[model samples]
Target: MRQFPLEMHHMAPGRVVEWRLRSTAGAQSPGPDGADGTADRRASFNQDKHFTVAEESRAADDPTASWIAVTFEVAGPLDEDALTGSLLAFVRRHEVLRCEFRRLAGELACAPIPAAELALDTVPVADFDRTEELTRFLVERFKRSIDTLSWPLFTMGAVLREDSATVYLAFDHIVCDGMSMPIVVQEVERGYEALRRGELPDPAPAPSYLDFAEEQRSRYLSIDEHDERLGYWKEFMASGDGEFFPRFPLELGVEPGRMYSIVNEASPLLDAAEAEVFEKACLAVDGKPFMGVLAAVAVCLREAGGPGVYRGFMPVSERGRAGWGNSVGWFVNTMPIEFDASPGRDFEQVMASVRAGFGEMIGHLDVPFVRAWELLAPREFAARSWPYPVNFFSYIDMRKCPGAERHEDWRPTSHVWSAQANGACSWFQRDAEGLHMNSIYSDTPAARRTMDGFLEALRETVREIARHGSFRRPIALTPPRRPALTPLDVAAFARRG
Candidate 1:
């Protein structure tokens, strides 16, 4: 599924109802001793959560609340009661959904409610008459309602109609990421079907995200910047101008330390047939499809006057082991990477660089990103947003995800929303139809022009690779004029030769 803005989606008119989590015991603050009528078993915030809370804490009523959402359809009318049961069962299946973030002793803590006491109330909001009005309403509701400081950090709703219904759910980034979208759809659908049959959905027990966070802290919490495991990160920062975050080479017209509204766009790059051919071409060069795509992106940037040495960070999945794949939470580790995209390099050579760069990055995943930021850039770490524009790239192949086979009928789509940004992030998703690139960047005249040109070049470069087994950087037919050389300069050059 492609990750795009929710406003771009077509909303059908129907009765809008929300299934929000309810509890008899409301949010409970910790006692003087850090106990809330229960055992002191609260899990410390993971690396991602630490960074998120720090950013949000910088400003009160921050508009850019981090959230990822999903929308899908169920055919042949809507079952209100069955759907309510499914929503409840789905939330209970994932322990993270039962969690609420609160401050205990000046630090963020996650406390989960008991499953037995958990309840879902289906509150009817409104019946939108037009899809246009409905779209606006959902966007505003999602932006205003899902706050990280609150207990119920997620919202679920369904649009009822005679022939079909559209279901959508949004969660704070503290509880979910892009990968969790498909799993949410699969579990909700399965639970709904089984409930309709008057039976229980006997899926495997999902591991708790709180447990995963605890394990992560046990392994990485003690390490500091002096630890030898951070040698890779140290060297990476040293390689640059001593900047922890790499800047996008192109100008984005964003002022330093200022955040602007985001412009979200998604477009197709190639169809299934062309994607297959592109994959075959990548295989011919002994590289994976992702590597090929990265190579193309690097080459495109260089051709657009970017530095020949590409430097950026990619979100590497921490769900490398069993049981954690099905568990929902932010299982991402941001790792830095750089590869040579110098002049005169062919696509195959760039792919080799990408392969080596990727391999080297994974070897040093022991250090968490939040720790590195705190050590390397303490001032910026304390801010609400990134210091400047940072280049970010993410890729996902949805064909391998659960419930992908029914994507044609379900028409599932994932969406991401943020109130503001200081940089550009491009996510490439491969589904059944084709390979598509979804981008969210600052809304500025310069940013729009730069990204437009970059996307155009990237599309052609990949298509050329698919057409042939290899691709070479196109050279200008007429080289620009050189400066006139003085007698002394010519002599110096001749003597060096």
Candidate 2:
């Protein structure tokens, strides 16, 4: 599955139906009596705590930084009732979905909702005669409905047609991660099919994100700013001249202390066969595909007049253990890495440097990024967002994720919307179809030009590594796909974070 902005989604014209959860509170009906909910609470993991607290302090009312969503299609006409039941089952199966977060006495607390106390409300939004109209309506609806500060922080909907239906579900980032998208697709499909055949979609209870967070905080909360475990962070900061975050090497032309509308762009780099060849080439160099991708990015940036030793933030998965693998939540930690991409370095040489850098970073993953930042940069910790746009990169091999085999037929696509950003972040994803890159960055004249050139150069460099196992310095690069910026409008750039 690919992750792109909803603006790029292909929405078909059809009747729109929305499904949301309603607490069974105050219902007098005795048909399905459930126990009262509790105040069972725990300290959130560092990431969640930082995010929620930041939301509490935001001055902007933009709800654009609200959600990560998935859209997919299933065969047959709409079955509103069966689908609702299936969705309810899906939520009940994931404990994290049953959670509601709030600030209890200045601390972010996660309150768990019993599955039985949940109820689904199906509403017929409206019918649209055109895809453009449908897309416009849904984008607004998503921004309006999913709020990060609220409980039941998710929304679901579908477009109904005679032969097929498209399903879309959106959740606040506090409750899910990129890896959670495929799990949603798989479970929803299974539940819907089973419910249609009059079979129970009950599956084994997945592990709880609440428990995971509690355990994590319990272990790391006691540490102080002087802990030796933070040595890696200190060295990384020192490498950047004692700065905590790396700046995107090239000029983005952004002013300090201001946020701008974010640009979301996604496109393919290599097809499936080409990606396989790339993988084989990487293996030949004693490195993995992700390492190769990083190497190419390093080289491309270096060619763009960046530092010879590339340094930036990389997001590593925290779901390392077995139990949390299938659980849905924000299971990620951002760490810093630096590798040589100097002139005269071949692809294989850079790959070796990346492999070593990645290994060293992995060994230091025990220290949570949030904790490290709180200790190292407390002043910026209280800021509305990252102190400045952070230099960021992420790579995911989705082919190994759960339910990937069905991705071809399911057509599941994940989406992330950002209200604004000061810098750029790029995610590289490999799946059944090909290798794709999704980027969100500040929308400025210089940023647009820089990122366009960087992405194009990186693309060509990666293709060369796949075909020849190594490449010389970048040749004359191609012009960016869009030479000029398009006007950001309500349908296109409607919501602000």
**TM-score against truth, every candidate:** 0.91, 0.92
RMSD each, Å: 10.7, 4.9
Off by over 4 Å in 1: 26-62, 203-205, 472-497
For residues 412-473, write the lDDT of model 1, one tens digit per residue.
Answer: 88888777888899999887666888889999988887887777778778888999866654
Which candidate's lDDT is highest? 2
* lDDT per residue as tens, model 2, 190-265: 7888888989887667787778888878888898889999999998888899999987888898999888998888
Give the alpha-carbon lDDT of every model. Answer: 0.78, 0.79
**Residue 232 accuracy (lDDT) in model 1:** 90
Model 2: residue 55 alpha-carbon error in angstroms: 3.9
TM-score of model 1 vs. true structure: 0.91
Model 1 lDDT, full chain set? 0.78
